[model samples]
Target: MYADLWSFALSTYARPGCEAACLRLQAQGADVCLLLCGAWLEQRAVTVTAERIQALKHIARPWQTDVIEPLRRVRTQWRAMAQQDEDLAGLRERVKALELDAERQLLGRLEALAQTWPIGNAIDQLHWLEGLAAEDAANLDHDALQQLRVVVTNA
Candidate 1:
């Protein structure tokens, strides 16, 4: 397991099928950064609690909504136009970079918040993924969620 959340996220995301699974979850309204953090916490055997989940959401929601989402919207909006124009493509790429940096910052904040939480204390450590997932958990893609779980456990 990685010593840091960001490293863990990077490695986990690079696993085969993980990226697509993450994207699928994201499209379903789940916060990928939060899910990744939850995966890291799960790997470390951190106990999932309402307060902890709320705290993670408190930090993640605003950053994702105010910082990351706008950058993504801009980048996505420019995708087609950028494909037709080199200048727009350059600007879009920059926006994409900024979006990624913003996500990294959010991950850092999440790690700082969760780093003090003890690990290996949970009787059941499998809640992180579902707990950190979108509020509409019943509607989420179970297959994608399972894929992520398999990748994390196998790692």
Candidate 2:
């Protein structure tokens, strides 16, 4: 296991099909950073609880809404225009990097909150993913979730 959430996320995201799966989940209204953190917690055998889920969400939601989403919106808004303009494309790339950095910061915050929590208490680690997923769980893509779980476990 990677000792930290960010390291685990970086490695897990690099695994084949992981990026696509995460993107699909994100499109379905799931918070990708939270899901990645969920994967990290699961890999570490951390027990899931309602309180713990709320704690992580508390740390993630604001930063995501205030910081990451705006960066993402700007980068996405520029996609088509950037395709035609080299300068816009370069600016878009920079925005993309900022978005990534924002996510990293969010992950760091999440780690700071959960790092002290005990691990190896859950018999079933899947709870972290399920708990952190969208409120309308029925809409979530099970295949993508499963792929993420498989990759995290394998890693």
Candidate 3:
């Protein structure tokens, strides 16, 4: 288990298939911060509840929408042109870093919010994932979710 949320998120996201699962869930309007947090809690065998899911969502949505998404939008908007333009490419790289920083900040806030929550004696694994993505859960890839579960659990 990670000592901090940022480390956990970084390691988990880097795991094979986790990125695809995140992106797929993102397309369905799920917040990656929440997903990462969910995974962190799952790893620690935290008991997930509807109230907890909402709390995480409430804490993450504002920063993700206001800070992270704009940086991501601009970086993505310049993707094609950045490949051809040296200056834009450099700026785009900076934006990418900024986006990552913004996400780290969000994770820090999340860590602060629930750092005191007790770990469960029995892990209700994937309950957070299902709650966070309940509206679009059916649309996501089962295999990718399974891969994430395997990686997270084994971590």
Candidate 4:
């Protein structure tokens, strides 16, 4: 659930010309998926005691590196873009078109980078695509494009 929602929010928030909007949302305290995931882990611990809490924290520490750090990286990029003076309209338009042509697949390039994902976790595999440059993902192969179909339902 964190993976899916985070993946969806990541791409939407990173729209080329929407940096200001993304920052606004973040400032309002959204995109705190890590916090929610952490809470979930804590609650699911064997007991609601100090030992269980410590154990949950230990289990979740490594995940913070893999999952939380990616989201933080995305937030960093969004802040940088939000502060830039560059005009991103044209680039955004180009990305939309390319994404459309590729059948609205947003995760294509990232999937290619990872080569493949575990069985039954296809949608979550898109988690690797957060904060990426759309231009960098512009060139995708067939399998990558197929994986991207996970982003846009109608695609």
Q: Which model scores highest in lDDT?
A: 1
lDDT digits (tens) for residues 89-150 of candidate 3: 99999999999999999999988877878876545556776676545677876666666678
Question: Which stretches in model 4 have alpha-carbon errors above 4 Å?
Answer: 1-47, 82-155
- CA lDDT of every candidate: 0.94, 0.92, 0.81, 0.34
Candidate 4 residue lDDT tens string, 36-65: 222222222212233433443344444444
How big is the positional error of residue 14 in model 4, measured in Å on the Cα after superposition? 20
| Prediction 1 global C-alpha lDDT | 0.94
Provide the TM-score for each candidate, comma-separated.
0.98, 0.96, 0.91, 0.26
Candidate 3 residue spans exceeding 4 A from truth? 123-125
TM-score of 2: 0.96
Locate the minimum summed-lDDT window of 10 residues in model 4. 127-136
Clashing pairs in 1: none
How many clashes in each structure? Answer: 0, 0, 0, 0
Candidate 3 accuracy as TM-score: 0.91
Predict model 3's lDDT versus the native: 0.81
Question: What lDDT is obtained when candidate 4 is compared to the true structure?
Answer: 0.34
Residue 73, model 2, lDDT: 96
